[model samples]
Every structure is written in structure tokens, then in C-alpha cells.
Target: MQFSADTMFPGDLFEAATRFAADTLAAGDRANAWQQAVAMGWPALLVDEARGGAGGTLADLGAVIEGCARHPVGLPLVRRCAQAPALLMAAGSAGADDTLRALCAGQVDLDVVDAPALTVTALADGGVRLDGVLEGVDAALPFTHVLVSAGALLLLVPQDALPAPTARFVGIDGAQIADRVLSGLLLPASAVLQRGEAASSAAAIAQDLAIFATTLDMAATLGATIEQCIAYLSTRVQFGVALATFQVLRHKVVEMYVDYESASVLLARLVADTVVTGRLAARDVALCKLYLNELARRGAEASIQLHGGMGLTAELPAGRLARRLLCAGFAQGDRLTQLARLATEPTAARL
Candidate 1:
């Protein structure tokens, strides 16, 4: 499963994803494919060797995600593989050990949906409580645990204890969107990842990891969108000529390439910096998430438009690819919110 630097074309990643997708479609086992992927060491690749991971770099993990996106893997690889581990590491908790082990062993399915708090629901000496609902939780369905952040406090709650499931909505990917009522879910002292954070070192790590995960997700979508466009243009014909041969179509395809390349380079640079500095700014991370996610969405939309009717059908892979990209756009944070945060934050210039 190793890729040589020279042989690691985006096409290679696409082919791997396509093969996985074909197998999933043939077996009618989207969940199984995701399980197999996890068991084959996808999660372990994101954790450091000390934390039961394979010690792979962020770029390496991004490549795996890129490959997985080419097919319908049915698992949130970016969040589980990249975000959760980084958050645990930053939180400095042995409590996360069980969760981490389960993740590496493919024994647990975890999903996180965090939002800024609107009101103080509960207050205690050592812990505070949140009562707001987060927008995207469907991909986290059957999630073992849900991670919640309010102010500087981060809480981990068993999914079953959530107040209500009435907040659920349908996501772009057709998964259940998680919108749950917090009400008064009690958070114990042990549940908090960080308390009263003035951007503690551990909290910083978690934030950076979250940002890293979003960037990787963008990379995955970019890879898939590019591949779909290529496939569509190759087989689709127009006016006794290939659609790819038209000057307009050629320009669109090249634009897709440029978008993918720019996102890829940004991801690579972010990964390298994370390894070297072990820290990245929240604003910069938001910018990356904003730009990359938007780029991916645009790329997918362009691919669909170019492919015409077939692009919207379930029988065509481009449809699925587009759905996944759209879903990823709202996974970590909404694009508008991220953009606004980036614009208003003093760190905007620094990033």
C-alpha cells in the first residue's frame, strides 16, 4: 500500500479509489468497505507510533483519504483518522486511550460535531455545560461518542445520552445530519478536554489537528472531482467529437486541474509545517478549509455540468463523487462561518 514519490500520480490514487468503489458497489457493502479500510490500517496511519499509529505524515494520510474518496468508502476517514487522534493527543488524557485503541483496532465509530455556544446552560466549579445543537451529525450516526466544545471546555458524551434525535436532517450525501438537543447533558470533570482555555498547548494541538483534517478532506474531494472530470470527458461525446476536444471543455478541465494542484500544494505545505512546528494558526487553518472546500465544490459542480445528464444519475460515479465533496464542505465548519472568522480575526494577516 506504499506509493513511491515518482509513481504517486493523482491518477494512481483515483484508480485505487475506483477499484474500491467498484468492489463496494458489487458487494453492496459500503459499511464493510469502510470497515476493511480501517482494519487495513487507515486509522493507525494517522496516529504517531507512540500512540499506536504507523507514524505516517499528514500528506501520507491525505493520500489515503484521496484514494478512499475515489470510491464510496462510507466512513468519515478524515475525522476519525486525522481529527480525533489529534484532538486526543492535544487534550493530554489517558481517557482517550481506550477510544484511540478502539479506533486503531477498528472497534469503534466516532463522530464529532462542535459549534460555538449561544448560552450558558450549566455552570459548575470545575465544568461548564452547553445547551445548543450542532448542525452536522448524520455522518456520525451510530457514532459511539460525540465531542462537544463550549467556550474553552470540550466534552465527550455517549451518543445514546443525547437529549433528542429530532434535530436530525438529511445531508448532501444522504446521511442523517445530526442536530441534537443538548438540554442539560451533564459533563463530568473527566469529560472535559480543556478547561478555561487561553489557547493552552494541548488545545492548540487539537485545533491544528482539526484544521489539518479539513485540509485533508479538501484534498480528497479535489482528487475525486479531478478523476470524475477526466472519466467523463474521455467517454462522453459531442457532435461526432469527444467533449474533451472542445476548446471550452478543455479550458474547464484545465481549470479543474489548477484548482486541484493549488489545493494539493497548500495541503502539502500545511502538513510539512505541522510536522516541523507542531502548531498552526486557527485563522490560517480556517482559510485553508474555506478555500479548499469551496474549490472542491466548484470542481464537482463543473464536472457535473460538463457531463450533462449522466452526471446526476446514481449509475454514474460522478454523482456520488459530487455528493461526497459537498458533504465534506460542511463537515468541520460551514464555509461562510469559516470565511467570516478568517476575515474578522486579527490573525488573518499572520496566516
Candidate 2:
């Protein structure tokens, strides 16, 4: 069966994003993809209208994400548009207004890093020194700024203040990642985006929202990948008959469909809860993250297996979609990390 995200977003907006992704992202032009997405006001999707943004809801953002993911577009909409805007809203500071405007206008790109590896030292001059290595930060090339989460404090550092990434790699979906070594980098009090009890609380909420948003994007990608598998099975012939005609292969397709639909139902409820109540139950979000990760893994492997050797080749969408699904599973927090977090929750103590 064909999967469409028309119900999630306005028809015009969804179509526009799909067309753009197909035309631009098909060539792997993420830089141009970023610019075009900006021109379309995508970065402002989650920002408030009062703050020079469209003030759209998280579900609305999901629609755009789904549209792009239909072509398996790998732009960092979740990080830049959804998470960054939420962070700025939660940690508004003296220069945050200009930062938000620039971000929404696509004049700048930003990524949030939760660096447990970093050692933060408070200096007598009301500054802090940072030293450590930041691992697996999902950022675009030439990241103009980075929002560093060091313990209870959040620091916004410009690109020039830090050296080049110690290592760079590409994610399965074609986004850029960096591993940076921070050695005695100093930040004045002014660089602190937020701190203390209130800041810590806001940062946690922002992180939860980002994780939930990533799950939503993963669901979209998985759905599209399933559709890709179905299309492939229905067309390519072997032994003088279409693969879809085979009972075993058809059952595999059915299994994938069931997984996608089941996840969709759960995601629908969580998204609605978040929209109505303005937050998700932490336990529910964690559970959903793990479920979707496994679902993506299953779908990717199945798609690959069904396509045989060709599925592993980049020339086909199967490979790209599989890569994206596998990689996205690790975003926000990997399976092991999330599980450990759940183990520490108050509710988990009952078990």
C-alpha cells in the first residue's frame, strides 16, 4: 500500500516540501536544501509568531518532516527548526532575540549538544573553562553556533571560538556529524544561555521534546521505506513471476505494514497528548523511542532482505532509507542509553 502524509499537514505545504525534496535532495544537495527550506519558512515552524516565526505546532512540524522523509530527505529540521526554537524560547537571554530571528531566517544554523564528557571550571572572572571531547554531535557543516549543555549550564559558543571538528562523518540520512575536542576553551558569563534550577528544568523539557520529535521523523521514514519495499516487490520479476505474487514475500510485506501501523497508533496518541497537555509523560516518550528504533531496524532489514543484493547498493532508495533508519535509531539517545535512563526513573523503582 502507498503511504501519504497528506492528513498530517496542509496539502499545499506537504506537496511543496515533497516537490522540493525530490528535486533538490535527490541530488544530495543539503546546503541548497537548507536554503530552500528556509525560503519556505520551515525553520520558523515551531517558533512563535510573536518571535518572527510561524508559531506552528509540533504535529505541523511532523507533517513537513514526513513530506521530506517521503523522499527520505535528510535535512536537520528536527535539530534546527524544532529543537533550537524550543531551546531559545526556554532560555531567552539578552541576545536571544536576534539569534532566533537569524535562525528562523536561515541566516544561521545551530545544534544542541549534551556533553557529559566535558569538564566545566568556573573562573574568578565570572567565566568558565571547558575541556573534553564532544562525541557524535549532529550538526551541519560550518556550524555557525553550538548550544553546549554542560552540567546545569547552557553555553552558546560561536564557531570561531572553537577549533575545527576533531573528526567529521556523515549520518545514514546524509546529515553531518562532528566530534570535537575542547581544551581550555573559555566562555564569559555572557555566553551562558541559561543556568541554575530554572535553566536545568527548561533544558530537560527541551530535550524531551527533541527526542519526541526525532521519533516522529523516524516514523515517517519507516513508513516511506515500507512503501518503497512494496513498490519494489510488486515490480521486479524473478522466475517468470512478480515477487509480490509469492506468498512468503507478501507475508513479509504484511508484517512490515502491521509494525508501521501499530507504531503510528501509539505515536498519534502521544502527539495529541503533547499538544493538549503541552508535555508527554517521560516514561511514555522513552518507551516510544525504543519501540520506534526497533521498528525502524526491522523495516530497514526487511526492505534490504526483500530486495536481495541490490538493496545494499546506494543506487537504490532501499540502501539510503535503510541507512537513515539505522542511524536515526541512535539519535537523541541510543537504545542502551535510553534504557539505562528508564532504569533510574522513580516509576521504574516499582518494578
* lDDT for each residue of candidate 2 in 143-244, tens digit (9 for 90 to 100): 688877777887788778876678988766677778889899988877777777656765766777778888877887778888788888888999999898
Model 2: ten consecutive residues of lowest lDDT: 1-10
| Cα-based TM-score, every candidate | 0.80, 0.91
User: What lDDT does candidate 1 reach at residue 257?
Assistant: 79
- The prediction achieving the highest lDDT against the true structure is 2
Q: How many clashing pairs does model 1 include?
A: 3
Q: What lDDT does the true structure give each of the candidates?
A: 0.65, 0.77
> CA lDDT of 237 in candidate 1?
76
For model 1, residues 1-351, the per-residue Cα lDDT tens digits are 111111122555445654775687678766677667666777677677776778776656666666665565456676667666666656656666656766676666666655665344545665556566655665433567766555565567676777666665666666656567666566666666555553244445566566657667666656666677776687777789777678888798779777777777777776677667755667778888888778878887887888887778767777877777777787666788787777776662221
Q: What lDDT does model 1 reach?
A: 0.65
Best by TM-score: 2
